[model samples]
Target: MSSIKYLSAILILVGLSTCGAKNLQEQNTLQQTAVQLTDKTTPVVNKNTATPKEEEEEAIALPPKAPLPSKKDSTTAETFNHSRWDRILQKHVSNSGEVNYDALRNDPSELNIYIDALTHNTPTDAWTKEAILAYWINAYNALTIDLILKNYPVKSIKGIKNPWDQKLWQFGDTWQDLNTIEHKILRPMKEPRIHFAIVCASISCPKLQNKAFTASTLEIQLTQATKEFLNDPTKNELTKDAVQLSRIFKWFKKDFEITGSLIQFLNQYTDFEISESAKANYKDYNWNLNN
Candidate 1:
């Protein structure tokens, strides 16, 4: 009977121990399931505690744009008026032949008019034609002088390139070459005096006249210019043995020779007798830009 009691006690103890282990295992599983549920419910955020996805969406919603002009702003006019230009021409002619450095530099509006007249407008009648051509040439020279004045202290006219290019010599509003202006406009009219009238701002260039050239006196003006330039000691000096002449005569020998020999051409305006020997010594041109 004692053996039976001992066996029963052992069996009871084993059962209790097994039940406790099962309970502990169930509690561990419950704790693991609770941790997994908490992990699924939690929200992820940046270190700054703000939603990174929301910040990115806000940045995408707004973008920068260019600023627009004010409603009251005005547009610029491209083409200048002719009547306004005519008034400027009047002022320009009044001060012709004389070098008005200040006026030329200070007044770009008037200067632009002069440039327009030269580059765009054409003289209709014979009288107006001569006047306009003379005006344009004078204006070109005057503007060149004005340009030099602005950049004064420079060694040469080549220092300023805007108007000096051979390509820029065009008719009003039309793109034309200097040769075109010379042959088409000036030559057809038989204005040979232009050879001596238009100054190119070179040491050997014709003297810049003090008075503006007008149609009424174009012929006489050109003639007198040729005569005066040939007679001026600074321009040309002739002696029995030798002659020192403006390098222009040497450079444009073909142009002068077309009408007559260079000596013959000179004789038309100068009283000084030049020998064939003098013509042979025709010196090379000094191309230094005349400021």
Candidate 2:
């Protein structure tokens, strides 16, 4: 009986020991798996946190862009106020042949007004067309003169470094050059006398009119300009020795060609008799700084 009892006790002890060993192995396996999962999840969380900082740093390294000037800000706002410009126009109407550029330029406020008007004020209809053209041309010339005066020692218009290029005389708004105001707007509108009407602030350029240009007297003003330029000895002289003339006749030969031969074109506005031989010696243009 004693031996059987002892054998049962030994069996129970061995069984208990085996069960404890199994439980310990299972516990170790579960712990290892948990450690691996924690290791993987920790890196994923760290990686997510790391990426945004790099992206933000890269964004911070870039420079800011410049703001573009609005059309109104660039043109009209820089030229003149509407009411003051009207008053100047009224004054011009009172005397169509005498403009006071000195008075206009002297008043810094009025100069600012002119600049604002030129920078803004786009014409939308025919009624405004003539006025706008004349206004812009006058504005461009005046502004150019102002620029030259401000930077008096500069050699040429090219030295000023403004945005004027040769093709600036196209009619579209995209080609809004100083030359465009002069040739495309002022000239092609069949205001042929505009050649002498808008001054370039140089001896070679047309004389600056003392009066402002108005829509009502635009035609007559243009006619007088054409006639006066052609009649002027410095511009178009018909002589046997040599045909001394303004370079404008040579530079814008194509413009005159539409009317006829240069001499024929001149004759339309003047009483001068230009011979064929005299017309043949058309001189080269001198585009010196027209200050």
Candidate 3:
């Protein structure tokens, strides 16, 4: 009887162990199923990726840019107003680049207003190199107009008594002449394209553009005007192997040597390639006032 009772207790222990093992296995399977279901049902978010609408909103959310930096006057210069000159240029300079000098001379008030704006808005340390360039160009053209009106009915700009040398204009509180501005200021800027931008009130010179150069658009204006001047067949007379350039190139050859040769400079602005050893000469500069 004792042996039978001991066997019965052992059997009971074995059955309880089997039942616990089976329950653990079923619990593990249910846990795995729940995990898989959660993985499928829950949204998987990838922070790295964005929708297209988000990109458009980001692009459109930019703030308005200030024209001039809002800084103290002690640290900055006044912004130059080039609009007055633009208006005057549009009114007087024709679409074909012919200057109505008679009209320009008669309507001195607009020119005076532009000069006054220039005189007051002399750029300082706050100004950019572009601003300085635009200033001098407008100054040169305005003073040229003033000089022409002062002595109207003149055939050539050379007719004036040492026109370039005379300190005929007031630049801010200091006095400067056309020669000083061209040589001392703009030339040292090392941009030869100013040759095309600065008009000398002559037929041979670059045509007085109907628009004024502003600091905002100085770079594009300079580049475009240079290209136009070089590509103009009547002005440059370019060919496959020969180039008869304006007298301006001969006069300011050193300025165009940024690429080690004048041919390289001319090639930059011309569609037709000019040979490096192409026969180069200057045509006679017509000095008659650009009418």
TM-score of each: 0.53, 0.53, 0.73
Evaluate model 3: give its lDDT: 0.84
User: Clashes per prediction?
Assistant: 6, 22, 0
Error of 1 at 111 (Å): 2.9
Lowest-scoring 10 consecutive residues by lDDT in candidate 1? 72-81
Q: How many backbone clashes does candidate 1 have?
A: 6
Question: lDDT by residue for model 3 over 135-176, one digit each (tens)?
Answer: 889888888878888889898999988988888767678787
As for lDDT, the candidate ahead, 1 or 3, is 3
- Residues 22-85, model 1: lDDT tens digits: 9999999999999999889955546576678777866677776667644333232122223443
- Candidate of highest lDDT: 3
- Tell me the tens digit of each residue's lDDT in model 2 across 48-166: 56688776776687897799776544533332224454555445322323334444445547556665555555554433455665676566655555555455555555566663443
Q: Evaluate residue 205 in candidate 2 and report its C-alpha lDDT on the 0 to 100 scale.
A: 64
